[model samples]
Target: MEKIGTIASIKKEATIYKLTNPFRWFAKFGATGGLILFFISIVALVWANSPYQNVYEDFKNINLTFSIGSFVISKGLILWINDALMAIFFFVVGLEIKREFLVGELSDIRKASFPIVAAIGGMLVPALIYYLFNQEGDLRNGWGIPMATDIAFALGFLALLGSRVPTSLKIFLTALAIVDDIGAVIVIGLFYTETIHLIPIVCAGCIFVSMIFGNRLGIRTPWFYLIFGIFLWIAFLKSGIHATVSGVLAAFTIPSKSLVDGHLFVKEGKSLLNEFEVSFSKTKTIKHSQNSLTTKQESIVATMETACEYILPPLYRLEHSILPWVTFVIMPIFALANAGITIEGDLFRSLSHSVSYGVIGGLFLGKPIGVFLFSFIAVKLGISKLPEQTNWTQIIGIGFFAGVGFTMSIFVASLAFLDSNSLLTNSKIGILIGSLLSLTVGMIVLRFQKQK
Candidate 1:
């Protein structure tokens, strides 16, 4: 009986560990979110063009307001989706950025150089391409729009290619996207906001100080950071800077260390488990009343929770938790609200505009050339080496795949032109056309390579 019980215990432990593996968790979350986003986008497109178009517009325009005591905040439903919910998205991005720099692919300069250089080229070429077409107009601000890589879309597309694409290539693509996000965040912070308030800026600074101090004081509870993070977000919103930047700032301050010593956790956990066993024997059943358990059982739960808190790291925990919200809920709603550009018979006329040409050229032409050329230079200079299984052909194919810039391009297009309705319409057209082209071209190239 004792031997049988030991075997059962071992099986249960193995099952628990398998369920909690981080890689499986990430892949599951990412896959589920991607599917949700894809369906949401389809629904949005259908609804926008449906007989209930007015209802769609009205829903997006609805004013949402919340007040506490004397303070109140109000925004259109669209703005709430973009500014508030997307702030959480950016916060998760910031956490990913911090994690990569600290320990992931970006931790080693040698490993990082290829993607870093490629990202710079990817960003610069797109901006230059956009500027060349819009040098004389307000459409210039839209240059950054095509510079982003929608990792979800890109990775999803890659997944369709199956074993044809190498694992190294996927890692490279992910790293490049991470770097691209950093650049986009910088641009948004510096160039997107139009007004400024000094008081809120100062308040943000104070909150930042508190966050740093909290980390220094070894505060491990997530609640400590969450409360002050809200304050930081409010301050940045009141200031001229975008509120999302506060998310990035707060992510940087999360403590990475464990509260209790590792040895203490192990020793105490074992002692508690021993006590739990004796208590379970007394009960003569697998179940014990919650109230009947001694303080040791409660202590075990607390210790285990604390150990998870420390082992997982808050930045990673937040990223994992928030990814689903960003991909499934926030991004889809943003698309539904923003992607409803009315199509008319004059869609061709819109496509002939300078904004259209800039967006098309930047994404379709500039992205591939820039990413490939810069990566070549980095390899030549011995700053970075290409992954072993990746060839020049694969690199070029990946470059084209990088051109699918739907989300970020649309976002920047909104910010870039105010009165140029024709320009905005054309830019969307360009994005659709260019992204489709890239997808087709990339798949063909990859398929051909695989056949060889």
Candidate 2:
């Protein structure tokens, strides 16, 4: 039976994944929030180069501290944005990754092959391009910047095209972007991390392991994971590893299994329906009460909430609950904090520097070439199949969109050029230009393909 179950799992699952519920939130609210992010970015740019630049600079440097007994955290506003708020963003990404592997597009190996293979190509070719351009010196470290494809921005552009997009294309893009995020996390955790503090790392490991044990023990409460996860994050922050990685590590320990199994859920649902019918017969509703639920009805309704939780679990609930905040608030704050590059006279020259060239080449040229090339080869080799109803033209269009590497690319740039203000500015120029170009070209192709 186990062998049969494994084989069945190997087979492609049905297209149960849809742009509904929380995914819909990412589409609708995410797109709206993407617009907010863009506006905030523009505000940052204007404020940075304007006469008020010093004020903005001063505001960012204001030291904020919090303390509890002997323990305290002291950081600037920028650190709070990069190190703290972005950690929540990564947490949501971790939850999505967990869900994807367990039951989404990535559940079946064969089905997962298309995006995983394409994401590999997408990452490698960009890194290689950046390396070729800047292999001589310090700028080589920024290669990972181009390897990201911001899922929110990419999907926001797709959402703009409305019914013109094929559902398969949406699924493919989402899956590919998620895989791309996994690669970025790996790169940050490995190459970008600096000097390590082993003591803190060991401390974090012990707590993380305890979280896993808690999951195994059927401890489904969220507080245990979250409170411990905070300790783990702080440990990583001190350990010289990026604190955001702790979120991903914590996410793996979240129980994917529900309290109620599918068959049991269905059976319970039918029993509840019968109970509802019986209760309705005995309970009288007042017209002035506007069909107010009777005591029996209220009791049944309350039980349904528990059943819903049984079906969804805390992992999904947390992801769904916080996604809007991440999109609407945290992401915009990140943009406002990080996107304010001073495009002064000398800074414009820096836009033509080596770091700029490498990043632009990698994102604008390398991204499309690599994505399309790998996906084409995968289909040809029979390793994966094309998404339904999507032709080569649409595939090419999707490849272009894969180059829109804004959020994660900028995040990586902050890591890569943590100290060099000049190189960081140059890299930001490349990211902004490359991403805008991808958006412009991708939209034209996807929107007008039917006309052609």
Candidate 3:
């Protein structure tokens, strides 16, 4: 009977492993989010062009409301996704930005110079190109569109190249994208904002000040940040500073230092674990089943869990918990909500508009040129050095990859041409063309590079 049960358990474990193996492989590949984003985008494109286009429109326009004692927040489904969910996405981005500046690639001025300079060139050149093409009218507001980089898409493409690409290059791209996000947040705050409301701005300031004090006072609770963060978001939403900026601001206040040091955590953990083992042996006679943990064992387990929490910074904990949701759920929903646009009637003529021209030129031509040229100048001027083991050709190839600004470009397009559906459609079409070209050409360039 024991042998039969053991054999059954082995078969069950094998079945579970077989079921989970594919997901594990995908996660290991490290571009799972990008693949999902691409799939959602394709679905959106198809649905927009299919007979279900009306249904898609109806779904987007569906009204959603939240109210608390006559304080109401109401918006269309699309706006709710963009304004609410994307706030969460930006919050993650903010946490990443904070972490990078504090301890990651951007921590040291000397080591950070390369990616920082490269990112500056990346932003300035594309904005310049976009401005040149759209200088005449409201089209100029879209210069910020190509100034952004979709990090997930860019990094995902790099992940596909696998061992051929150097780790330094990936790190450089990651840092560059982060800097690009900072620029995007600033642009949205400065250029994209409408009329400013002083009352809400003051409210947001006071809330942020309280958060700063909380951080200094060693308050490490996630709930404290979450409650304050929602209020901050609401304040910014009413303050005319694009509520997403509040996400970043709130993230900056998260405690990056742990309550307990690693050494202390390990010592405490070992003691509790020892107690757990002793309790387990004592209870073994009373309860043969694994599920039948004694009170002492449960207390030990709870203590170990608390120790685990103490050793991890709130910033790291929040990011680790929230990133998967942002990547898998929020991003896919955002793509579905925003990427749907009908492609009909004189596609060439639509693509010929100055907005389209600016977007395509900025992303396809300007991004690589700006990134490579500025990098060259920085290296020549001795302001920065190339990433280790990365040559100039690889830099050029990465410049092309940086040109794949799908997500952020579409976001800027939505903001820039919100009043004009035709202009927004043109910009989206241009982004698709430009991003596709950049992705294809970048892959070709990197794939054919000679290994050193």
TM-score of each: 0.86, 0.90, 0.96
- Model 1: pairs clashing at backbone N, Cα or C within 3 Å: none
- Residue-level lDDT of model 1, residues 1-452, one tens digit each, is 76688789899989988888875666564345545555666677678778888899899889999899999999889778777777787788888888899988999998998889998998899889988888775777788878887777777777778788888888988899889889988998888878889999999999999999998987867899999999999999889888888988988898755556778768876876787678667676655553365576667677667666766667677777887777767777777776676666787777888888788888888888899999999889888898878888888888888887876677667666645776777787777677667767877888778532
Worst 10 residues of 3 by lDDT: 285-294
Q: Is candidate 2 or candidate 3 better by lDDT?
A: 3
Q: Best to worst by lDDT, what's the order?
A: 3, 2, 1
Pick the lDDT winner.
3
lDDT of each: 0.80, 0.87, 0.90
How far is 4's C-alpha from truth in model 2 (Å)? 64
Q: Across residues 1-452, which tens digit of lDDT does each residue of candidate 2 receive? A: 76677567555342334324566565565367657777888999899989999998987788999789999999999998898888889999999999999899999998899989888899999999999988866788899999999888898778788888888888989999999999989999999998999999999999999999999999888888889989989999999999889888888888888888998889988898899988776554433332477777789888987898888887888888889899889998888888888886885587679888888888888888888899999999999998887888887788889999988899999999999898899999999998888888889989998732
TM-score, predicted candidate 3 vs. hidden true structure: 0.96
RMSD of each: 5.0, 10.2, 1.7
Please give the lDDT score at residue 209 for candidate 1.
98
Q: Candidate 2: what lDDT?
A: 0.87
List candidate 2 segments past 4 Å from native. Answer: 1-30, 285-292, 346-348
lDDT of 1 at 129: 91
Off-target runs (Cα >4 Å) in candidate 3 are 277-287
Candidate 1 lDDT (Cα, 0 to 1): 0.80
